[model samples]
Target: MCSHYEPVITKKQLATHFKVADLEDGLKPELWPGYIGPFIRKHEYADVGDDAVPFRELMVGSFGMIPHWSKDTKIARMTYNARSETVAEKPSFRDAWRLNRHCIIPAQAIFEPDWSTGKAVPTRIVRTDGKPMGIAGIWTGWKNPANGEILRSFSMLTVNADDHEFMRNFHKPQDEKRMVVILQEEDYDGWLSATWQDSRQYLKQFPAELMQTQTEAWTTDLP
Candidate 1:
C-alpha cells in the first residue's frame, strides 16, 4: 500500500505539464491518508457533453475512498489502497471504476518498509531517472446530507509484485507482495480515457530496473 509519498513538484509545474488552467497554490510537499494532494481528472461542466470538451483539470483531493453512499468518513482509512485485481468488482471502487472516474497521482518518491535485513526497515523509493511518476488511481465523491458538503477522495491501485525483484523486497514477509501501478508518460491520457475493460490492461508493475531505493536504519537513541 502506498500510504505516504512526496510531491516534489509545484502545482504550477503540474498545471503546465498537464496543460491545464491555473491551480490552487499551497499543495503539500508530502501527503498521507486523509491529507489533500493534487489529482488530475476531466473538467466538469454542466453543459458539456462527453465529447463537448476534453479539457483535463487538476484538483486537490484527499487520499482515501469515501464512497458516495458512505454515512461517515470512518471508512476512508481502509480504502486508501484498492487491489487492482478486485478494484473493478469491489464495492468501494466498483462504482467509480464503472463510471470511468480514473485519476493520476503524482509523486516524487514513496515510502515503504524493507525486510531484507531481517527487520522491518524504512526506505524511500524513486525513479532512477529522477522523473516524477503518475500513479494510477480511482476517485469517489461523497456528500454529507447534513450540511450538503462533498468530500472528494481517491485510492491508489496496486497489483501483485511478488515476482518483481525490487518491489518484492518491501512489506512484511507473510503479506502478499504488491505495488502501485505507475503509468508511463505516453499512457497518461489514454489511462484516463480508457474504459474499465481497457483500464485493466494498465494495471501492471513498473520495471524494477528503472527504480532506485534508499534505506535508513532506525535508531533507539533519541536526540
Candidate 2:
C-alpha cells in the first residue's frame, strides 16, 4: 500500500499528456493521504451532439477517499489505498466502485520505501520512457458538517505485486508486496467510462520492464 506519493505532474502535463482542459484549482506538489491532488474523471457536457467537447475533466480532491457516510475527513488517512480483491466489498470503497466513479490520477513519479539493505531507503519509481503515469482510482464527495462544504476525495486502487519482478522488490521482505493500478494511455478513455462489471479488468499491474526504479539520488525532473 502507498504511504504517500509525489504527483509532480503540472497543469501543462495534465493538458498535453492526459488531454484534460476543464480543470479546478491546483493542488500541492506532493500529497499525503489527506492532502489535495488532481484527478481526471469522465464528464459529459449533457450533450451527445457536441463532437468538440472534452470528455475528461480535471478536478481537485483529497488523496484518500472520504466516504459519504463518514462523519469526518479523518477516514481519509486509512482509505488512501483500496485493496483490489476486496474493493467491491469494503465499506469505504464499495460505493464508488459500484457506481463506476472511476478516475485517473496523474503522477510524474511515485516514492516507495526500499528495505533491501536492512534499512528503509526512499526510492523513486517512474516509467522507463520518463512519461507521467495515469494511475487508476475511484472518487466520491463528502459534505462537511462543520462548514457544509462538499469536497471530493478518492482512493488509489492497488493490486498484489508479490509476483511482480520489479514492484515486488519494494517494502519489507516479510510484508505483502502491492502496487498502484497504472492504466495504459490507450485505455484512459475506456477506463473512466467503465461500468462496474468491467472495472476489475483494468486493475492489473503494469509491465515491469516498462518501469524502472531509482534510489534517493535523483536530481533533475523529467522533461
What lDDT does the true structure give each of the candidates?
0.81, 0.87
Per-residue C-alpha lDDT of model 1 across residues 106-147, encoded as one tens digit per residue: 888887878878896667899998788889999989898889
**TM-score per candidate, chains pooled:** 0.88, 0.92
Question: How displaced is residue 89 in candidate 2, in Å?
Answer: 0.3
> What's the TM for model 2?
0.92
State the lDDT at 137 in candidate 1.
Answer: 94
lDDT of 2 by residue, 58-126 (tens): 888988999999999889999999998999999999999999899999888888889999887778888
Best model per lDDT: 2
